[model samples]
Target: MSQNTFDGVRTAIIANKVDGIVREMTNTLLRSARSAVINSARDFSCAILTDDDQLLTAAEGIPVHVFGAQLQAQALRAAHPDMREGDAYLDNNPYVGNSHAADHTILVPVFVDGEHLFTAVTKAHQADVGNSIPTTYHAAAKDVYEEGAVIFPTVKVQTNYENVDDVIRMCRTRIRVPSQWYGDFLAELGAARVAERRLKELVAKYGVETIRQFVTDWLDYSETVMAKAIESLPAATLRNTGRHDAFDPFLPDGLDFGVRIDIKPDQGRIDVDLTENGPNVDCGLNLTEATTRAAVFGGVFNAIPARVPKNSGAFRRVVVEMNEGSAVGKPKFPHSCSVATTNVTDRLINCVGAAFAQLGEPYGVAEGAVGVGAGYAVLSGRDRRTDEDFVNQLCITANGGPGSAYADGWVTYGVPCVSGLMYRDSVEIDEIKMPIRYKHLRMVPDTSGAGKYRGAPSFEFAYTPTADPISVIYPCDGQIAPSKGVAGGEDGARAAAWLEDADGTRSQLPNTVAMVLQSGQTVHGFDASGGGYGPPLQRDPRLVLEDVLEGWETAEHATATYGVEFIDTPDGLAVDDAATERRRS
Candidate 1:
């Protein structure tokens, strides 16, 4: 075979092997993980990196984990100058290079033929990391110390496959669920071992030098491709701003979150500066450095072409700057940043995408779900039936708004920042885990952003407390403020929630989780919709009629909101072309 043929074969084999390694890693973690977050929701990521710490490939997991680990890898090498073959490090400190303290990362260096080849890393999000509150993301806290747990960099947890009892004991003691924590840690180790064996096999088949060279070449090629893509984009600086409700317990006054992006075409780089953001609060909305980086990368990647391979190479041309004490960027230590990942990070990405839209037409996707939608229900007090330690369960529901697109209206159930991601947990599962019953769950009709291409509709879910008295927490934004539209498209509808009782009494709901519900009371949640793109009047009459018949748009809505007339025919809905043309004129 020719040299080119040999290189092609080797690359193909390595790619397949790397892909298999990640699949096995996620499968192993899912099978063995103790918590629902890991096993059921699959809130974890696995990746293979070169020995020098360049990310090669990662399975479809959390965006933050994928990019955050790349930063962590570089930080690890810098922090641990004397990293050996048998040494494994465990880290979760956001300051060092992580999204937050709760996101524990386990990394082990892979060696073959007495030579360091790559590193296998598994990053998992734990429900609780021994925070001040039951959930690691406490919205009421002020500083990082109040947030929950913090693990520093270069914490050696394993040596030559031996269990580090000290580290294990410390983690087990700190977290609420020790059994789950231990199980996740073991699964991470198992994943690393699996990668190690596969990597060694590749080294045995192909020479170690050849494998190393391939890694270098692959990363270099990826970087070149990313840089070239950046160069192709129009040169311009775009600015956008977004906001989130302040959740500071000490400071009840609301605050604003902002972002500004500067794109440099000549240098083929995108620089994101968050220095003009809101002041730091004692709330959990504050972000750490690692979380900020992850959010920025997520926004950039989402706006760019999806064919681009995600790796450290892709981020090589991007530079992000944030104030050390700002709400959107890095925050001072000991600040509660539990909600940063869900709330602040999300807004950051939206703001960046909004900025990108100004550069040209069809630049980025519109905003989707903005808030964390954390509905925490804690059951205390003694149970009349069992009389055991009345179990208190805290759960979060996935509520998403529609996202706007260039050609079509916003996508319903579309995830922003991270595409193709969904939060899973049905009412049946919630009932089995806790004492709750869902009364009504369905999509909210006519609650989408109205435009030529209409935004996707939002969803609504109503649940009643069945077993014991429970506290319901709802953290959301875009209620008073609607998602902004680009071009001439209209903005999305404002979000709202309420509590309805069987006694025909209804009360407004707060964004916080302080309200307690009785056994018969029901809580209702309404998710917001995404902003629309382009002018509503420009919408096709035929498409408007189709939407009316499909129930996405009512006949009245088509006439009023979209300025398109529709007639109900015997066969189906038909567009009134004369009326539509007159309305447009």
Candidate 2:
């Protein structure tokens, strides 16, 4: 074979091997992960990076994890200039380049022919990290110390592939689930080792010089592709603003956030400015810089075609600007950022897209569900059955809302924030481990925002604790405020969660986690739907009739909202187009 052919073959094999390595890492972590969130929901990320800290490839993982791991590696290399062959580092401090304290990152240096070539990392989200509260998501936290666990950057947890039992002991003593934390830590270490072995094999087969050239060439090619894609977008500046209910006790005045995006086609760059946003509050909604960047990447990546390779080169075409104290840009140390990173990130992405919509570049989409559902529950006193503290972060899925597109109705029950990556564990599986009984779990009827392309439907879940004493904590918003529609679409319904007791008493669930439930009492949670795009009046009459028949829309609602006239025929429902047009007019 010619030299070019050999290089091409070697590149393809290395890339394919990297992909397989990530898949295997995911499988290994899932098999060993003890929590339902990791093993069942798979809320973790695995990736490979060059020694210079460029993200090469990542397996299917959360946006926060993939982005956080990349940033973490860059920070690790900077913090420890003398990184050695046997050294491995662990970090979760939001201030030191992590999504948040709950997301622990493990990094290991890969070597070939006695030369350090790259690093392997695995980022995993822990359900509990020894916080003062039952769950690490403390909406009331005022500072980093109150936010539970905080791991420093470049903290060597292992040397020469040997376990650093001291660090392990410290972490195990702090977290609620020791066995699970230890298991996950081991899984991360195992994942790193897997990547190292695969990388070494590739180097051996292709030779060191060939592998190095491929990495450099691939990164440059990726950068050019991304730059060209950005340059194709029409040059323009777009601005959007969104607000979440300020239920936090510290931010009694209410909190609001705004975004400004400037797309410069001449420079092939998109600049995100969040300087005019709200100041960081004492509440947990504050987002660290690392978390903010992750959210930005999520929105940008989603707008781009899916086939595009993700690397540092892709980011070179984009620039993000935020004030030092802005909520979305800079987060104060020790603030609870768990929810803000996901919820606020979703809002920022939508705002960016909405701004880009005016550029006429087809670079934007309609809003979808952006809130994070906190399925928190606590069991009071020791469980007589297990003789241990009873605490669990109930498995909650981020339900899908409507997505904006020119064709077809919005995706019903789709993931709004991170898209269709994470899913809810089965109700049976949830009940088996937790002390809750799920009575209802389905899409709420007629909750979609009505429009030419209707928004996705919201969901309603009802559950009651079966154990002697259990408390529920619901950190949800969109009750006093509803997700707004884009263009001419109608607003989505508000989300609400409340407790219904046997005595017919009821009360609203607070945004902060607190003791709010008991045995024999039921709690109902309703998620908000995404906003629709376009005018509802433009919807096809036949589609309206079908929606009514399918139970997604009510007959009366279709007639009133969309001005659709339907008649009952022998076969089924039929649309009266003439009447519908007359009613619409």
Q: What is the lDDT of every predicted structure here?
A: 0.69, 0.70
Candidate 1 RMSD to the real structure: 3.4
Candidate 2 residue lDDT tens string, 7-75? 556566666777898888888887887776677667678888888888887857666667656678878
TM-score of each: 0.89, 0.92
Candidate 1 structure quality by residue, lDDT tens digits, 43-71: 67888888777778886766767776767
Which residue pairs clash within candidate 2?
A: 143-334, 144-333, 144-334, 400-414, 402-456
The 10-residue segment of model 2 with minimum total lDDT is 374-383
Q: Which ranges in model 2 have alpha carbons more than 4 Å from their true place? A: 1-16, 304-307, 334-338, 374-383, 406-417, 541-546
